[model samples]
Target: MEASPSTQSPATKARLRTKTGCSTCRQRRIKCGEEKPACRNCISASRGCVWPGPEELDRRLRKFREQLYPKTTAATKATVIVNNVTPLSPTLLPTDIFSLAELDLIHHWLNVLSDLLVLPNADPACVAGHSFETLRMMTGCSGLKSAILACSASNKSTLSKDPRYQVASLRYYDEAIRYVSDAVADIGHGSKAPSDMLITAMTYLWGPDGELDARKHVAAAITLMKIRYQTAPKQICDSLAASWWYRVVYESVLYQAFFLAIRKPLSPDFDVDPELFQLQGESQHLEPFATVLERQPLILGLPLSLYYLMIAVIKTPQLPEAQRQAQLLELRAELALWETLTDDDKPDADVHSKFQANAVALFVLATSLLLDQMCEQCLLAGSPAELTTTSHTRWQVFAALRLLHRPDVSEMWKRCYLGAWPILVVGYSAHEEEHISSIRSMLRQMVERTGYGEFQRILEELEGLWASKR
Candidate 1:
């Protein structure tokens, strides 16, 4: 019962006028006197005279030329043959021809990136090749063509500083930010439940600029965790909710710890004191591993394991000497917990291994930041005895950096040390631009190879630090 294309109503054709008229007169739904160039209506209306109506414009000129010289029979036949070729079908249009499978592949790639952000210890390399493959396929999609153009126009490192690219990048980054914000708003009103993947997506999307708004996302995540924790049956707690709750707690605490480490204050509206502090404390006492051992296979345990460790580092700067000493004792306890998880008897060996690696990297970074802060404290308090401890802390951080062979981690350490180096060296009368230049050159090379754009921001931060010192 499909309608035939040939049976469809024919389009109305516009009629040709023999008279010339003003452009305005032709468009006004009025009749024009059949006159030559510069019609009577145009002259009365004070409009510029225009020649020929839409349909008659070309035909009249052709007729006038035909009067001067007629076309041969062969030329007329060639024109007839040219008009016989039909236009391309709608289904075969450039934009309509993409395979559904290609669209699904692009969706999968986007989801993988989302997975990396929320899940702690996710391997970015797992989707490395897939990203390029998706980009290749996406080139065919006309909808994505505009995105490709925008991405290409704004992708240069140097041009990132230009105002035009800055505006475009902000637009793209804002769209992503708005997406997370909308999800958080949904969870806040209890209108929608928060998923683990959603939390991961928020965390993954957060860049340096995201530090300010992260508390909102973290709060929503915590609310979801509390709801899940309370509503799940006891049997489900052992079988399902435990690992899920742990991830929620871990990521929530990790983001909070990151905020604290960066010296950003928590929002006044966030008042879930117990949930915040509870995750900050040792996970062993907070949640029993024995209860969740069977379900560990289904959860990522690394974020939970590293949460306590990172919190210890975040607490270092604010803690008094006695409190820090006590916390170090607790840190040793948490480190022991980490060691125990790596034991052969652990139920989820793969998760434990990844968690161990991430924990080691975070612990090292936290330790470095702690040592840097401690060094600053000692200098301020004029404590000469603490210098030895400071040196030992630096050595520990250096050794830890060696253990973590990741380029991103290594670059972070380099910047941290670079910030502290001037203080250490200049204090001891060893300041030199050559030394600074050499480090800068090395960092530039690292940035070129890795394409981690945040380091450029770090470099600017370092410049400010050096300027402040001088």
Candidate 2:
């Protein structure tokens, strides 16, 4: 859900040859380059020559808006601000900046990380589109801000191969933990306090450079949420409903499921779809494969459903064998349905839609993994070559990866950000040397393109797995 591309005004579109613009002009992001004390542009513009402070950013943005959108009324501009400026804690990902490297990390978080967190067609209001837009709306919350900084710095270290950045990340992480812990301990009847505590705990998992106990943090948040829901003031509840608090919960659950390889409890009351989609329109350009499992209502409604079901089974290992068997049979039947579904699935025509269709196939494959666990049967699962072309988990993953070769999907394919998880399992099942080589090559490319450390680790694990068998 990256922010819609800003329409570059004709005046601000070009890099005015102001390689030496004054502090004031630079701050305003306007064009100007002249002698100190009073540049001609400044004099003509009737502005001070001194360095404009951060406080003046709003004024400059307004001036630019007036110039560019002259026809827009004040009320219309306010509407724009409301829609565009859902600030998430002053856009601070580093907490505090020191060197240019840290600054670059912040930039990356704003641009790339935000994109990775959301889909291209996601609702901007729901997802943290661009960091600035989110930062604009975020009110003060030190612990949450610190956790975000830690995550950013962690990513920066991974991307830049700079160990020094980890230092700041660790500091911020520790600060967030301390603040959040204290707040939780002293939750003495304040309505907003519990929400703040929960937000801090949820955000900690997203931070970098630590063996964070995510389950503990989540438990704290859950406990606080129960208390807050019952006792919090109406205003606070409304704010939490509209704010990213639910997003925090979603992320925490995802982290627990992904990293721990287990499911957390899903409250019947919890639902995030309304936040994700407002207009219940069709799949847009992605309609060709609309009936595929990826496009299926269930998977689309909750992409994380497979993960949730897996976690539930794992968490409730105490379930009776009869109940377990019944559940497994039900899930397996669901998987079988997806296995035969291919009517509009292959969209080689539109590469963008093809990428999405393949994504759905990946989800179907994920379903297979759980089915194998439940039925204790291979059920179309085997070595890469042995896999059924249309259905098997290994085959689907291979097929999905193959789609990346298309020029349209190649650019995104190179970015291992989205498909890492599926690849990990796909690589694990690669028995043949050629299949193993292909998976390895794909992961290496993903690592090179995204600087996502996990891709490299997955590649190494797969290599080790293959080696051990040999």
lDDT of 1: 0.40
- lDDT value, residue 227 of candidate 1: 54
Overall lDDT per candidate, in order of appearance: 0.40, 0.50
Any residue pairs clashing in model 1, and if so which? 118-200
lDDT of 1 at 419: 24
- Give me the overall lDDT of model 2: 0.50
Regions more than 4 Å wrong, model 1:
1-169, 172-192, 195-201, 225-307, 317-362, 365-393, 397-453, 466-470
TM-scores, all candidates, are 0.44, 0.59
Those runs of model 2 whose alpha carbons end farther than 4 Å from true positions after fitting are 1-105, 120-130, 137-139, 188-193, 196-201, 209-212, 221-304, 312-327, 341-343, 346-355, 373-397, 403-407, 413-418
Please provide, for model 1 over 1-470, each residue's C-alpha lDDT reduced to its tens digit, 9 standing for 90 to 100: 63366664444233333343345566775776623334678778887755433244335334543664365345324322322222111111122343332222233223322232232333433333333333444454332322322332233222223344445444545554565566567777785555444443443333323446545655655555555454553543453443443333344344443333333211122333354336345533335332342233222333443543544444454557767656656665555555443223334456435444544444434444444454465447644222222323244343333433344344333322122222222222212454445445545543443223444544555566456546
lDDT of 2 by residue, 1-470 (tens): 42333865666554323224456777777776543335677888898865333343333334553575568555434422322322221112322432334344444555455544444333443444224433432335656656666777776565555576688788878877887777877776454546543454454444463234654655555455445534644544344345443443434433433444431121121222221211235523212211122232211223455545544433332346456556666666766776554234564456556666655566456545534543443343333222232223445545645654556666665653556666765665567777777778878766654556667767886788789768
